[model samples]
Target chain A: MNPAPSSSATDAAPVLQAAGLRKSFLSGEGSIEVLRGVDLSVMAGESVSVRGESGCGKSTLLNLLSGLDTPDAGTLTWAGHPPRGDRRAAFLGMVFQSFYLIPELNALDNVLMAARMLKPPGAAERARAADLLARVGLAPRATHLSTQLSGGERQRVAVARALMNSPQLLLADEPTGNLDERTGDAVIELLLELCRETRTALVLVTHNAVHAGKTSRHLSLHNGVFQ
Target chain B: MPWYLYLALKQLFPAGRKFPFFTAISVLGVALGVMVLVVSTSVMGGFGREIRRWTVDTTGDVQVRADGGINRPADFLAQLTKVPGVVAATPFAEGVVMLEHNLKPSYPAVRGIDVERVEAVTPLSKYIYFGKLDDLDDDSVILSSQLAAAIGARVGDKVEVYSPLLIEALKSDEAYLGRELRVCGIFEIGHQALDSSLVFVTLRTMQDLYGRRGSADGFDVKITPGLDPDEAAARINAALPPALHGHARSWMEINHDLIFILQLEQNMIFFLLTFIIIVAAFSVTSSLLISVVRKTREIGLLGALGGQPRQVAACFCFQGLVIGMAGTVTGLALGATVLTFRDNIVAAFTRLTQSEAAIERFYQFKQLPAHYSASYITAIIVCTITVCTLAGLLPAWRAARLKPVEALRSE
Candidate 1:
């Protein structure tokens, strides 16, 4: 009983923890509640999948946890830093549904752009960006504009750009939704390989029960809470 | 990399298929704005100075006189020299006179000057086309080429001088008795103000009309270089004896109307030509807006990477600034080229005309004046930059305040 009193006694490493979280979206009529006093714990170096129906607010919960959006009432912290420009960008990396690569920049330039954001005056930042681009197997296309890359390559660049600052948390919102199953598996494997090597906490928001089996922690979002 | 300006610009103008069009418009706006400003500015600058010189060379900087009389004392000329900015005080007499040739007479303004003192004040002696400055001492007169040709008189040809100054005879006062005099000199200034209406003679000639008194109506004084005419006049005015009220004025004041017109033209040209710059700025803004709209995904990505709202705004603003700067540089180059060859260009246009003489008379300038002052150049540059930065505001704000979620959602 005395040892169970400490919060660290739980299996979770407390990469991110929320207590009695609440969120409501204002519709034309009034407000539609999205989450109702939910509590959850996610550990460091654990990959979790959230599955729910279309209107069950799985993305909303992931956004809240990643600090992309704020909950109406909740206390959440990640890597000991709250959501802010530098730390948030450094702590969490999100793969949006529609690969948001800067179109004007080349693949390496895109990755370099995010790296530049991390430490502006850092010397040899370009070489580091080049290394990151090469690691993503885009060495030849480093100077090719994002528009030149195929959907898969574009997504790969987006993934590489996410890791530009070496993020501590990785969030994938239907990372495979836009690709064929074969290509999707390749991306999923890439995400898994990168996250495992970096020891990053991972969260996947998806409706595919198949993806749920790929993670150690799986939960169903129902009503306004997760169980 | 992280500065709001660099990031925003980097995001807004990604290399794409549309890059060529954007760059071209930027160059065009700059070149057009520069060309128009250069031509207009240089022309107006020349017009004003020619008018100024036309007046400066005619009348000495300051004209001093006894307030209530037609003549000043003999010692006045010597006393006038002590005044500051009085390089030389030369005595002169002027009166209306008639010149008769072949029984046909024409009237003109006549001035008599000392042969030596006038040398320092005017270049009349150097320009005598048909006669010499030394001949001013002869009983022979110097008739302007225009008046001489009209009267059918030439150097060594005799003409009668009928003075307006009257002599009192036993019965009543009468105009001076006519003198049959030889024409000794003829000068051609081509300045209509000088050529058509003026006649010069030796100071002794004007004295003879006044019964050989050898006195003058007033003295014309010249100022040293770098001296402000108005200030010199003020100093001379204070230096004068109370008996003589000196009228002091600048060369600009004497030709106020012509000067005013030149200034007005300069202003109108400046204002009208600035629209070119404005149009360029508009093009810059438009191009950047297109870039921002096209790069919506890129903007969204930057936002996702922890780009602050300010960074988005800065990027858009920076793109606009870049366009503006490009236009400014292009304009400067364009303006400089036009200004550099302004003369040859105008001469070419004038060559297409039927008569070079007619162009000369109409424009009153031998070569187009493209006088450039540092202030003028600075003004054009500042104005261009202002409009350029202002043009960027709307797109920059749009970029800055973009909602990351919404922007990412844009296709």
Candidate 2:
């Protein structure tokens, strides 16, 4: 379902590295281990796609990589350092299947929120947010509330928000799951194009095999391990 | 601004929205509680103030009295006026008399006042409603408004006064005739107790009727403005000789029981009305809890976007603070407006209910009174803001405890 990265890409150090990562959940009297010592590495400017069926620990892996959840036993690093709460905002960004745009804020404000989390947004941050919105082709609808937007438009806004802080790595968990096939294809294309143009790394979790094929590297997960 | 506070404000007063139902309702609840506290406390304070004013107006700032009638009042008066804070002093005599006009008889307390010095001490002329204080002489008397009505007497009417000495003279087997005096004026003091049962006569007339010459029961002392009555009374007590056995008491010390009851009532009202603000705080807590539950997914997204748990908690906490501040401001404005138009509002309501006369009969006030003290207003602000800020804690804790992974999974 995928191809290996080019020789030039592997020459650089990986932006995200995870090894021996494990996680579990309580199931009745006993516990069930969801992730068992998983290991992965991705280089700079690489778009890596992970495809899996439901409940295959794909989201759990994404959570651990983003530092939203702790791995029971593993070492995970972003740019060769352990994830810290204060450093998380400047190191990475995330996009969700639900798009998760705050309903109270407009499209432009939702994008600027990422930068605001890092620091108070100033003129440069505002310009970047506008440029990102224009890149996603939602510039004209920047002032519209998330509720007033359609599914495809909301995902585009989410993509713009994910890149607002110019983070090195973006973790997207089934971002296009809520949109139709044609819209999903367009979002995936725009996402890859933006990542490549900015030289930012991406880890996309998705169910569509065709969308997975478009990335620089693709992997399938089954029985809690990548194959 | 911090992102958390900025987002908090945006959540409460969202951009491009016409109506914010949650914020409006929450603010209104807190505002109403604050308004009631302000209005009720001010009205209670007003009643207390009015009582003090009339008490001092009727009795002067201080009254000096002896065990027996003071002998040679002229000497005591000279000493009384020489006190450091004493501005002036006037000698007075008091006794009960049987007053009869056109065969309608009433027993009323009568005060004998020195016309020239009484004005300097008690402002008695200000309360005169009919005729003039200058018209009162040894052959004339003044009646309280209600006492005049009871005897069906008016200015220029002749009334017979039977002093207590009449009974004493009769017991001694001596003939005594009641004095006939012309009514010269009627006064209304606006105090139910004082206005209903009192008459005034010249000091010389009272001395002759009581068979005491050149002597008076007590002297009313007026002190310098802004001087403490109790302090001035202490000064006056030190000025008189021990042989006179004279004791000076401030108006507050004389009306101690009434003042105590008024203070107790105001404190009880303040204690009871504070519960209203507590109830409003509970409403705020409930609303914020609901908001936290509803926004679980968005909160998870924030965590995914690198927001710390503490910052997320701050978002909800700031919302409560904003609501508290807005409600306090609005409530103060509303309370001030209502207090300004209190007389008109009372008039309209009394007219609508046809209870104008009933209010005067029961409350003894023709117009509603309101007073706002700095201390009481400060207490209200501090308590309301503190409770509202504390109300946000539970919801903030609940939000902070949520794990981003679990919250995202929640349906």
Candidate 3:
């Protein structure tokens, strides 16, 4: 697989660029504008955090970045080209606050499942999944189902799964929201280390100022624009 | 395995978890439907086969009759027996006659069959429960047990037999003779119609009685084993002389109305029983709907992991297919077991209730009959699986149309 464009190449072209993004929702009788206009950019191997109040569209921004949802009006590009449909998942991996590990599969299978979306995993990919699980400190729990794992361990597995396909960027929406303070810090630390080791750009969305402060660049969303 | 199929299997039979209750009920529903369909089909097939066997045994495989009486029955019988599939042929004369016995008169059909050739073409000799069939002679006759009982006659009792033609002749002031025939034998074929309304006499006696010295009514032809009676009849008809204007009919054609009624009843039962399977498919639909609702977040997760909408739909469809296949196999096994032990089961019931009268009154045979047809079973399985697959489509489509963001938001 092609390595995510190197930091030198990323210096010439950012990994992701978005401008004039807008989104809204229909309330009882009126439309609620979540984001009026937003502009953001993240370079390769860079870690950025977006901190906002609840309902301020932090998750919405992450969703748009992951291509899980579409902005009402905007131009969002990955490596200078629009990410289309499932190709977005191939280019970018997502980790959710709830640690959305499929309950039916074991930890190892869950990680492998993400790889399977791009292509059928081979022996080498299996080894990489094993390595990633070990990196997340859940190697011994590889065969344990999600139901059997602790909340922190499930989150770690989710983080491991997000990097399985060697995506160029990882979009984490409140990755530590469901964990206690200490467990959440550990999960954030592990997530940061993995992203740094792989040189994958990170877009972490959170409500915690301390977690937001750990990233290289910190931005706050207010009135639908980043500050 | 493909990822979608793997996911489908995992969702259906999740490891380390008890199987879901609603899914189990759906599977049971499908199994019950398939069981009833299979059992009913087998019973109906058995009934049809038995009826056909009885009809063929009583009427011979084919019957050939001329427009009028066959003048040279011996030559016609020779020609009939020469047909490729024709195994045996017998000449017989039939007419309505009145018999006076014990000062009582009754009308019954009198059939005159050649004693030597009758045994070759029919099971009439085997059905003679009392007396000897060979004892029938010029002045003697064999009466069905029911007819004999009706007339209060027995073997060695003399009875006067009068033909309608003979009666007409006498009424017109023409010479006619009534024969004093002795009842020589009594036969019971266990067929109510034949036993109650038919009597047997020698061919020469019937010829003399009817005033046709060398003519007979028809010839009964039995085909070789495994040959279709209709095809055999057609061949015989084609070979008959144009001047004779003879037509050969299969036993089924002779009892067309009865056979048609039986077939119609079987088809209606089959159609009605299929509804059971259809109803069971509704359970499948409901169960899948529940699963879809429960797994909404997981569906969104799959979508985020790059699963196509069509693939997501296929996962649920595969789940339904597995359930259907499992039910079909179990039902087929259950049906086979039931059919194999049907007689034993009935006997046990009979013993428990101490009732044999119901069986004797309702059925013509001592044992219940079941016929297993591979083609019919295949059709049932195919139809059941198709319905089950279709049942999955609604939920599958719903799942496919789900937006990943909305689904994930539910969690």
Candidate 4:
């Protein structure tokens, strides 16, 4: 059974809901069923960590929940309704294993990119981006290019970008995968702290049990189902 | 600014960095192409303009000729003066003559002009180098500079002229000899062919030599300023009496073949030079294609962050537009700078090669000229920007086709 929710997790509406989600990939002639009939739900201000072995469909599940890929079989909703194009930027944020920061933009600009997706950034948005960078401990490196930053600093900048729009939910797909053990611990702590303080729900997908244990609830993916 | 435009600029210039090498290389390629186009088109236009000016200066704006010859010169002159748009008119006759000076024989075209009226129709006095146009009398002739140099003749020297009329006189068993006239002046019209083999004499003297009295071959007419020569010629032709059997031709019509050739050369150069911009645009396409491939994951991040496919495409499209604008502006500036010093550059080049005289002989121009047509420049700007903007479409399509999940999963 999953652990009890943190105090920040309310008995209110769930930020994300997915039922009977399924995905398949073509491998040669026949197909490989990557994901089959998964169900997941996370409440506002709650942090849920999903741990799995290699190729356990954890990333595919995240992709489905984030609506980046179409699930062949089931229904999904964001805050009780269908996902919308216009609201996507304001409704959700995503972090990746690769950091995926645009090389041309500096840390501040990279963080501001998320806000820019919603609208052209004004002074308020700029201040918020700087504040988020400071929250993630990247205030000093705000002007540094992605190439100029260390791996941990880049990941922190990505975290700041993910929260720039103040989305209701944040999906992090092994964001600390490329960093060292010490840096990875720090990134996980920062993610959990920010999510709780902002009252934003978090779905953390990772292979590290220590990182997974830090969240309010933890589930392990075995085969294509949660165990 | 929109995020896509902002990103596009950052990609090209990239904050906190020196000029990007890729951007610089692409911009320079387009700049060189545009510079060549501007310089070449301007020079070609200059050649055409200079030719037209010289032609209208040597001959009048319009030339009136008869089916046989104008039988009543004085009557025709009075009638021409009454014609609307006719500023002035002068009578003339021309034929080839064998000229001998210092025992050297040369065949040259000779024109007989009305000394009093020629100045009103054509500015022949401005071309006189050694003597005055008023010095030209029935007993005197003005030799073209090159012809005078070829036969070692100078002002006040006497030269013998043998016209075809002398042969006809001999056939009739009439005692007629070649007319001898003093060279009263030397004129250079700055045209190779005109300055090389042309002579001028008074009309009465020419009539005495050719045995054609009280007649002229044609009359050269100058029209009111700013009036179209072709329109003036048409008016003159319509006003002439059918009994005269005369027609008027504009200077443009007289040199139609030469003007056509010049226009053809200019168009061909423009057509050929356009390929350089196409080549540069292709390079831009290539670079953007590579950028799309390299930034696949970042594109996925953009999509995941709620950037629509069209917005993603705009990012790449805007890059091409920025490059084109920057290149065109730089190219025009560079072209203008180079044209300003074109004469100096040509002088240096000719001096180094020791071909100053040969260049003058071959090009028939001592100084290079340039003319910038507004229409031509506008076409270049529009065409170049369009080609460059279109260049981005393929890469943008490729970028937009990427599925966010698949792109993010790309290793």
DockQ for each model: 0.45, 0.80, 0.52, 0.76
Residue lDDT tens for model 1, B1-411: 454655555544546565656666775786688668866876788677666665566567766655453355456766768777789767777777787889979887888888888777655665689989787763778887777777888888888887755434423753346867788888766565466667887787877754547677677668898898788878877877776655655666667788788888888888988898888888878877787788777676677777777767776677666666776778778877887887777678778865676876677555666677566677787887778878888888877776765676677
The Cα error of candidate 2 at residue B295, in Å, is 1.4
Instruction: Supply the global lDDT for candidate 2.
Output: 0.88
- Strongest candidate by TM-score: 2
How does chain B score by TM in each prediction? Answer: 0.81, 0.92, 0.80, 0.92
What is the C-alpha lDDT profile of model 2 across A89-138, one tens digit per residue? 88888888999899999999999999989899999999999999999999
Clashes of 1: 4
Candidate 4 at B240: error in angstroms? 0.6
Candidate 4 C-alpha lDDT tens digits along B251-330: 98999998899889989998999999999999989999999998898888889999999999999998999888888888
CA shift at B357, candidate 2, in angstroms? 4.1
What is the TM-score ranking, best to worst?
Answer: 2, 4, 3, 1
Where is model 2 more than 4 Å wrong at Cα?
A1-6, B173-175, B347-358
Q: By DockQ, is 1 or 4 better?
A: 4
The per-model lDDT (C-alpha) reads 0.73, 0.88, 0.86, 0.89
Q: Considering only chain B, what TM-score does candidate 2 achieve? A: 0.92
Ten residues in sequence with the least summed lDDT for candidate 1 chain B: B166-175
Answer with 3 or 4, whichever has the higher lDDT: 4
Candidate 1 vs candidate 4: which has greater lDDT? Answer: 4
Give the poorly placed runs of model 3, Cα more than 4 Å off. Answer: A1-12, B18-20, B93-215, B224-228, B242-245, B344-365
Residue range B39-143, candidate 3, lDDT tens digits:
888987887777776677666889988989899997888888888999999898999898889888888999999989888888887777767888888889899
Which CAPRI level is candidate 1? acceptable
Which candidate wins on lDDT? 4
